[model samples]
Target: MLDLAHRGARLAKEHGSSAGPPVSLLDQEVIQVSSADVVGLPMRCVFALTAMGFLPQSAETISADELIRVRISPAWLRLDARFGSVYRHRGHAALVLR
Candidate 1:
């Protein structure tokens, strides 16, 4: 998932996206994460990915924390996996999580 965000930023740069990468979503900062047991982690991931344009921006007013706390549907998981794989293949496969 982090790879996807990295790849998204790379592609965005290649295609001339004007918005600079968000500080929190920077590849340097993101790659350091291995495991986290923090509350709202999923919400944070969704927010970060969406902010990077890896995931489409949502129009719904539902907060990320609320949505994640309620449920993580299988379909959403599949989408995450699909996007991760796609980005991994596109030159972000070097990420090694320990």
Candidate 2:
């Protein structure tokens, strides 16, 4: 799991408020780890990896079958960290992770 996986993600919440689902950064790193179709997200820099930073997801959920679906046109790629992760499914809604 990437370092970012240990932090709390402010996913699926209203904008500008300190309330939402708390996702551990250490866990939930794999939806279908072996699936080749899975898109990986990169681990951002120190500043970008802070608690104030996260892959803003507009909509994310897990089905009974455990199929993790995510939607982001411009996936996050941290060239420096060389780490990859994924944002929860959000269709096309613009969400801020900070």
Candidate 3:
């Protein structure tokens, strides 16, 4: 997940967009990690990001079967350190916002 975040930050830097990479990218990353033991991880990722203010609190939730869907905004990747220790590992110290 931190790798994905770093990739997103790199992409944002390349594109010169302060908002970070598209939410779909992060969503795809989460989906890739989804498994029996990691069910609903995407929702949890969204919730965590939202809680950290990386994502907006007004995100809409959609329920389908056993899965919950949310639209991640472009502004959801501010790279703020307040987001948590996840960004601190994996050589991502440079990506964190001071």
Candidate 4:
């Protein structure tokens, strides 16, 4: 229920076309949210809270991956936004996100 669709739209509107996917693939879809695409403050708070152990992740599917994904996705987004050129050399956005 992270509501990424809304967040993505907002991000696109805010940044306009100046900010695009940091990495692009020839024929793949990127799964991670961009830093410029997420709701800034909320993602930061989620990352902090997850790091502090207040939001413990369980071994179940949802807890295991979603928790970590949500926590790190924003960081990846930030990295992509700031250092996209560097990452693009390593791999496409989909690979990095995965």
Please list the C-alpha lDDT of all candidates, in the order they appear.
0.38, 0.33, 0.38, 0.33
Better candidate number, 1 or 4, judged by lDDT: 1
lDDT of 4 at 95: 52
Q: What is the TM-score of each candidate against the true structure?
A: 0.23, 0.20, 0.27, 0.21
Tens digits of per-residue lDDT, candidate 4, 1-98, equal 23432354455466556654222212232244444444322333333333344443332423424332322343342222111111122225455433
Q: Residue 6 CA error for candidate 4 (Å)?
A: 18
Name the 10 consecutive residues with the lowest summed lDDT in model 2.
77-86
**Residue-level lDDT tens digits of model 1 in 35-83:** 2321122323543546655443444633444321212232232124212
TM-score of 1: 0.23
Stretches > 4 Å off in candidate 4: 1-41, 59-98
Which 10-residue span in candidate 4 carries the lowest summed lDDT? 79-88
lDDT of 2 at 65: 44
**Once superposed on the true structure, which residue ranges of model 1 sit more than 4 Å away at CA?**
19-98
What's model 3's TM-score?
A: 0.27
Error of 2 at 61 (Å): 19
- What TM-score number comes out for model 2? 0.20
